[model samples]
Target: MKVLFCGDIVGRSGRESVTRNIPRLRQELGLDFVVVNGENAAAGFGITAKICAELHGAGVDCITTGNHVWDQRDIIPYIAQDKRLLRPINFPPGTPGWGASQYETARGQKVVVVNVMCRLFMDPLDDPFRTVDAEIAKYTLGRSAHFILIDVHGEATSEKQSMGHHLDGRVSAVLGTHSHIPTADSWVLPGGTAYQTDVGMCGDYDSVIGMKKEGAVLRFIKKVPGDRLAPAEGEGTMCAALVETDDKSGLAKAVRPIRIGGRLPPAG
Candidate 1:
């Protein structure tokens, strides 16, 4: 199975980049499934039902979110109706949307995607390790699931790496998000899971993590609340990770990072 996991989409630039390129990418990469982090898709905040439809229309199979999953008020209700969208698994039990979902490809292959958030330097939610373990215990790779992918959204690289190692061999891939910078650590773990510290944001890199540079820089320099940071309107660069898994064992055979458009050098 071939799967592509795109990083967080920040704003208009990010949305355009993804919606415009996903079709071609699906054809060129021969991707069986595509997952993108849409937490920041709505003006550097949360996503909405309209944007979710846009992504799905562009051929994205599922969408995952991080801490900013609730930034937009309307999404609270809309999320319940969208099975393809997921929030952090560690969120309180009554959270509006699902934390994980199983999807079927065109070939009738089963794929499970889990979305979990880490607590270190992030929101204090349920124990991610325990929650994920309990959630994944229901499915056995190669038996119930053809591929298992987990999106570990967090601010700390150490926490992300820890989760990756902890779930190695049990899952097909453990990819990180939330930090808007791509890391160079795309590699298959010894246990067969593909891991990357961060897949990076699909937004303009010229700004501060996809935000307008002026306001973001001011907040850091002045140490005071000035203005709300807005998304950079520049052209965006879509960043993602590609993993091809074994059909029989459901383990990753090859992993590669993908970067297209904008300032970041192209990869994959």
Candidate 2:
């Protein structure tokens, strides 16, 4: 199965870039499923129901969020009803929505999408390693599910890498998010799980992680909040990773990093 997972959509620029490219990418790449992270989609904060609808209209099959999942107060109601939107699996119990879900492609290929957050440098939530391990055990890859995509959202690279290695050979891909910067290491692990430290943000790259550059610089230099952070309005760069999985073992056969528009050079 061929799947494409895009990083966090920062704001208007990010949303526009994604909606513009996803349809073409779906046709061009012949993708079986598409997963998107919109943790920062709402003005660099949290996602909303409209944003979720837009992403769905743009051909994204599933949406994932990170630490910023609940920033927007309106999403609380929408998340409970929408099965496609997933919060971190490690979230405390009774949290609205689910962590992982199984979906079927138009071609009848079964795919499982799981979102989990790490503990280091972030919220001290449940153990992600243990949580995801138990989730993966529920379904046998290549038998029960044709593909599995895990979004490991976190700040620490070590934490993300640990999760990748921990789930290697058992799932299709274990890609990182929340850092907003894509890493250079994009390769299939020895165990056949495609891994990338971070998938990067789908927003304007000219500023500080999709934020207004001047304001971000001020906060660092002055160490005092003068104004609220705003999303950069410039043209955005769409960043994503494409993985082709083996239909037999449900392991990655090949992987490619996709970067289009804005500052970053176009990559596939």
Candidate 3:
């Protein structure tokens, strides 16, 4: 199975970059399934039903979100109707949307996508480790599911990497998001699971992590809550991770980082 996991989409630039490149990417990479982190898709805050429709129309199979998933109040009611849109699995029991969902490819192969957020320097939600362990137990690799992808949205690299290693041989891939800066550590783990500390954001890199440079800098320097930060209005680079898994074992056969346009150097 060939799968692609796109990092967070910040704003218009990120959205355009993703919607514009997805069709071509699907053809170029021979992707069977695509998952995108859309937490910051709406003007750098939260996602909405309209944005969800656009991403889905552009070829995204599932959309994952983080802490900002609820920044847009309108999403509260919409989330219940969209099973493809996921909040963190570790969210409290009554969270609106699902944390994990099962999808099928054109070939009728099953793919399980799980979204979980870390607690370190983040919201004090349920235990991600235990929560994900229980989720994984629901489906067996290679038999019940052809591919299992986990999106570990977190602020700490150590926490994300720990999740990757903990589920090394069990899951097909464990990719990180929310950092908005691509890391160079893209590789298959010893147990055949694809891993990366972060896949980066699909937004302008010229600014501060996809935000306007001025306001973000002012807040830090002045030690005051300056103007609200906004997404950088420059060209965006679509950042993602491509993983190809073995058909029989459902383990990663190859892992590669993908960066297109904007400031980051091209890679696949």
Candidate 4:
């Protein structure tokens, strides 16, 4: 199975980029499923129902969120009914929306998408290591699911990398998000699972992690409140990962980071 996992989509620039490039990228890569982190798809905050639907209409099969999942209060109720939108699995039981969902491609193949958030440097939550184990156990090898993709949303790259290794043999792909900067270590693990420290944000690269440059500088330099940070405006880049996983074993066979448009250098 071929799957593409896109990093956080910042705001207008990020959304526009996805709208412009995702259809073509999906076709060019022969993607069977696509998952995008929508935590920052709003104006550098939480996602809204309208934006979630826009992502769905743009070929993204599932949308994942992190700590910012609740930034938009209006989308709370919609999350309960929208199976395509997922919050962190480690969230308490009463949290709105699900943490994992299954989708069938037009070809009739089943794909399982799971979202989990790490505790280190993030909101305290249920143990991710234990939580994922239980979720993976729900599907047996070679039965209900042929593909399983996991989105580990966290701030610590080390924790994310650790998760990639922890789920090496059990899941198809383990990709990281939350940090807007894309990492270069996209590779298939020894156990055949595709892994990357981070897939990066799909927004304007001209600013600080997709936020407006001057404001980010002010917030950091002055250590005080300034104008609200806005998503960088201008042409944006589409940052994501292209992964291929084995059907029978549900492990990644290959992985690569994809970055197109905007100002950042290509992944080498």
Residues 1-268 of candidate 4 have per-residue lDDT tens digits of 8888899999999998887888997788788988899998889899998898788888989999999999889989999998999999989989889999888998888888899999998888999999999998998644688888899998998899999999887888899998899988999988888899899999999999999899888876796778888898988898999988777777777898888888887652
lDDT values, one for every candidate: 0.96, 0.95, 0.95, 0.88
Per-prediction TM-score: 0.99, 0.99, 0.99, 0.97
Runs with alpha carbons beyond 4 Å of true place in candidate 1 = none
Ranking by lDDT: 1, 2, 3, 4
Model 1, 141-238: lDDT tens digits are: 98799999999999999999999999999999999999999999999999999999999999999999999999989987897878889999999999
Can you give the lDDT of residue 208 in candidate 1? 97
Candidate 1: global Cα-lDDT?
A: 0.96
RMSD of each: 0.7, 0.6, 0.7, 1.3
Tens digits of lDDT, candidate 2, 1-268? 8999999999999999999999999999999999999999999999999999999999999999999999999999999999899999999999999999999999999999999999999999999999999999999999999999999999999999998999999999999999999999999999999999999999999999999999999988997868889999999999999999988899999988999999899999
Q: Per-residue CA lDDT of candidate 3, range 112-216, in tens?
A: 999999999998999999999999999999999999999999999999999999999999999999999999999999999999999999999989999999998
Reference-based lDDT, residue 35, model 3? 95
